[model samples]
Target: MGILALQGAFIEHTKMLHRLGVDSFEIRQKKDLLLPMDGIILPGGESTTMFKLLNDLDMTTTIKELIQNGLPTFGTCAGMLLLAKTVDNYHSDFLGTMNIAVKKNAYGRQLGSFRTTGTFASTQNVPFVFIRAPHVTEYGDTVEVLSIVNDKIVAVREHNQLATAFHPELTTDTSIHQYFIDMCQQ
Candidate 1:
C-alpha cells in the first residue's frame, strides 16, 4: 500500500500502518503512485495546497482514474474533503469521486478544534481529533455510514473507498488502519 505524503500527519499514518503490519510507502510525487496495487491512503493536510500540488504534478487525473478503477482508498480530514463531490466555501475542483457533499471546517476553526470519543467499527470510544474537519451533509446510495457525531456523518465507506473526518492517526489506536488493510485484502 501507498500513503499520500504531501502534508499533514503523514509520518504518524506511516507509523500506524507499520504497526498494523502493512508494508506501506510514502507517495510524494506522481511517479511514486503505482497501479494494480491494493490500497492508498490520502493523509490529512491543507486541502487547497494539496490540490494545487497534485495538479502541478499532474497527479489529479491519475488519482481519479485509480479510484474509478476500483482501487481501495482511505482519506482522512482534508483527504476526506478532497474525495467529496462537493465542498462548501471551496471551489468545485476536488477529486469528486466519493459522491458525498462536505462542509469544510464544519467544526468552525482552529480554536474550535476538539477531541471526542465514539464507537468505530471494532473500536469503542475511539479518540477522534477534529482539526478544521469536514462533515458529510449527504452521501449517495452506495455510501455506507460508519460513524457520526452530533448527528453529522463523520466516517463513510463506498466500495473501495473509505473516509473519515477525524484524524485516527493522531490517536494510538490501530483498529481503523487495520480495518482498511482488511478491506484491501478482500
Candidate 2:
C-alpha cells in the first residue's frame, strides 16, 4: 500500500497500517507512486495545499490515472475532499475521481470539532471524530453510503474508492483500516 505523505496526518496513517500488519510506503514523489501497490490512502490535510503540491510534483495526473485503472483509495477528511467530484466554494482543481459533492468545513470551524458513535456497514457504535470535516451532499449511482450523521452522508464507497468525512486514524479503532486492507486483498 502507498500513503500520500505530502502533508497532514500521514504518520498516523502509517502507524495504523503497521498495526494492521500491512506493509505501506510513504508517497513523496510522482515516481514513488508508479509501483505495484494494492491500495493507497490520502491522509487528512489541507486540500488546497496538498493539491498544489501534487500538481507541483506532477503526481496529480498519475494519481487520476491509477484511480481510473482500479486502484483502491481511502481518503479521510481533506483527503475526502480531494476525491470528491466537486467542492463547494473551492477551486475546481481537484482529483475529482469520486462522484460526490463535498461541502468543505460543513460542520463549522475547527473549534466545532465533535465526536459521535455511528454504525458503518456491520460495525455499530463506531466512534468518529470530525474536525473541520466535509459533508457529502450528493453521490453518483455507483457510490454507496457506508455511514451517515444527522441525515448527511459522512462515509461512502464508490467502486474501489472509500472516503470518510471523519478521521478514523485519529481514533484507536482499527476496523475501518482493516476493512480497507480487506479491500486491498480483493
Tens digit of per-residue lDDT, candidate 2, span 1-186: 999999999999999999988999999998899877999999998999999999999999999999989999999999999999999867666999999999999999989999998998689988899999998988999999999999989999999999999999998999999989988889
lDDT of 1 by residue, 54-136 (tens): 89888999999999998899999999998999997777688999989999999998998999999776578888899989999
Which portions of model 2 miss their true places by more than 4 Å? none
- Quote the positional error of residue 147 for candidate 1 in Å: 0.3
List the RMSD of every prediction in angstroms. 1.2, 0.8
TM-score on alpha carbons, each prediction? 0.96, 0.98
The clash tally of candidate 2 reads: 0
- What's the C-alpha lDDT at position 156 in model 2? 95
| lDDT for model 1 | 0.89
- Runs with alpha carbons beyond 4 Å of true place in candidate 1: none
